[model samples]
Target: MRPQTTLRRLAEMKAARDPIVMVTAYDYPTARIAERAEVDMVLVGDSGAQVVLGHDSTVSVTVDEMLVLAAAVRRGVRSAFVVCDVPFGSTEVSDEQAVATAVRFVKGAGADAVKLEGGGAQRLSRIRAIVAAGIPVVGHVGLTPQTAVALGGMRAQGRTTESADRFVREALAVQEAGASAIVIEAVPAEVVDVVLPQLHVPVIGIGAGPADGQVLVLHDLLGITEGKTAVFVKRFAAVGDAMLAGVTAYAAEVRSGAFPAAEHGYPASADAIAAAAAAAAAAAALEPGQIAD
Candidate 1:
């Protein structure tokens, strides 16, 4: 079996200029697929809210829901690092509350690390507290979806000079606050290039552009997501279409009675068949009034 990926290994990969691969997985099957692909990291992202739980946004998922998803992913992951996203309300209350939530992910879901969004004062405090509690953290910055409305709705961040500076500041702050790694999303590649040298930890980009590593949602990459996806998402496979075709074929066969052919039947002894025939004849010979509806 392959050995598990550790924070040290991640840092070494970054230092060696080896491109890391990260992907979001919600459950066992997705985790197993990710493991089989030999990806470097598996994130049980709050993106599950939209991709798996049918939630309209990431804000609707709870810590309990996240734990269930994380644990399921954990069961199937053998080598890649598993990081669980702390949902919106899970860490907003206080530093202690954030630590408690992080502990739950580690103890309840076997998460190697917990990811928290943003790098505001409160977010920094939470990251510090969680790290102080001996839990590894993966920080997220640039277009945090939990507060997308406050960010002027699901748009790219760091596009303006002021926003770009803030984005850089927060990215550094999270690292200083003891995050082992950071995920930058929906920011300009130039801005990311500027900050890359300043950051010592592994940087994983989604829509943010070239970094030490890249992460994409598993469902989006596999074409399991319906409707439009983010601009950065590149569908690598048409699994959704394949699923539809398989189910359609099954339905058609069932309708035409082409399924469950003679080969599908169980063998019966001659005596059993004879007994069934006798029973059918006796029932048919009953008077119309005697046969119950």
Candidate 2:
């Protein structure tokens, strides 16, 4: 088995200019696939709310639901570091709430670290609080989905001067608040390039351009998510179409009575069958009012 990926190892990779690979996984099967593919990180992303649970948005997912996903991912991952996203309302109330939620991900689900969205003043405080509790935290900035409505409906960030400045400020503040790494999502690559040198922690980019690492939603990459996806998503495989084809073939076989053929079943001895037939004959012969011995 491969050795577990750690924060120190990730930092070393960043220093060596080796790009890290991270992917979202919601269940045991996906986690196993990620481990087999040799990904460096497996994130139980809140994106599972839409991709797996059929929720309209990440904000609708709760901590309990997130814990279930995280724990399953942890069970299947042996080497890749597992990070769980603390759902929307879990940490917004207070710094203490953030710590509590982070602890649950660490203790209850065996997460290597927890990821929190945003880098506002309150968000930085939450990051600091979680880090102070001895849990490693991954900070997220630029197009935070939990609050995307306020950011104008999931568009790319940092295209304008004001947004670019805020991106830089938030990115730096998150690093200063004790995040071991940061995920820069849905921001212009040019904007990310300018600020990359200013931050010390490894920056994992989604749509924000090449950083120390890159992460994509597993479903998006596997062509499992139907309809439109983010601009940055690159489909790597057609696993969804393959799955549908496989199931369709199975249904056809079943309808044709081709399934469960003789070869697919066990056989009983001739004597055994005869004995069962004689027992049935005896039972059928008994009178309606009488009890059979």
Candidate 3:
């Protein structure tokens, strides 16, 4: 078994200019695959709302649902760091509420760290409280999905001078608020370049260009998600097509009665068949007239 990845190791990797790799995973199989692939981190992201649970948006998922997904991922991960996303409402109530939610992920789901979206005042409070409670926190900024509506839809941030400045401010504030790492999503690469030097902690990017590391949705990268994906997603394997082809072939075989052939069936002894036939014949013969002795 591989040793667990620690916060110190992650920091060292960032210092050494080694790019970290992170992927989203919602369940055991995906988590196991991520571990086997030797990715640096596995995030049980709220994006699972769309990818796994078929929810329309991340906000629709609840803390209990996230806990279920996080725990399953935790069971399959051996070496990679496992970070669970605190869902939309999980941390919005108050710092105390945030600590409670983070505690559940650590105690119930075995999460190595918890990720909370946004870098507003409330968000920083949550990050600080969770960290004070002895649980590591990963801060998220730049086009937070939970409040995408307020951000004027699911679009890239930092396009304008004002927005770019705010983006940089939020990123730095999140790092100062006790986050061990930060994830920036859907922001311009140039803005991230400007903000990178100001940050001492590892910065993982999604649509936000190169940082200390990068993360992409597992389904998006593996070609399992149907239809359009974000610009940052690059399909590495057509797993969806392969799955469809496999099922289609199995269906065709079933229709043609090509499955369960002689080799697929269990062998039966001729003597046992004969004995069974004899018993059936005797039973039939005596049924109408008398009970068998």
* Highest TM-score against the true fold, candidate: 2
Where is model 2 more than 4 Å wrong at Cα?
Answer: 278-293
TM-score winner, 1 or 2? 2
RMSD of each: 3.1, 1.9, 2.7
Per-candidate Cα lDDT values, in order, are: 0.95, 0.95, 0.93
Q: Write the per-residue lDDT of candidate 3 for residues 1-293, one digit (tens) a residue.
A: 77778899899999999999999999999999999999999999999999999999999999999999999999999999999999988788899998999999999999999999888888888899999999999999998999999899999999999889889999999999999999999999988999899899999999888899999999999999999998889999999999999999999999999986899888889999999999899998885778877
Candidate 2 C-alpha lDDT tens digits along 1-293: 99989999999999999999999999999999999999999999999999999999999999999999999999999999898999999999999998999999999999999999999999999999999999999999999999999898888999999999999999999999999999999998988999999888889999988999999999999999999988999999999999999999999999999996899999999999999999999999999987879
Clashing pairs in model 2?
A: none
TM values, all candidates: 0.93, 0.95, 0.93
Evaluated at residue 35, the lDDT of candidate 2 is 95
**TM-score between model 1 and native:** 0.93
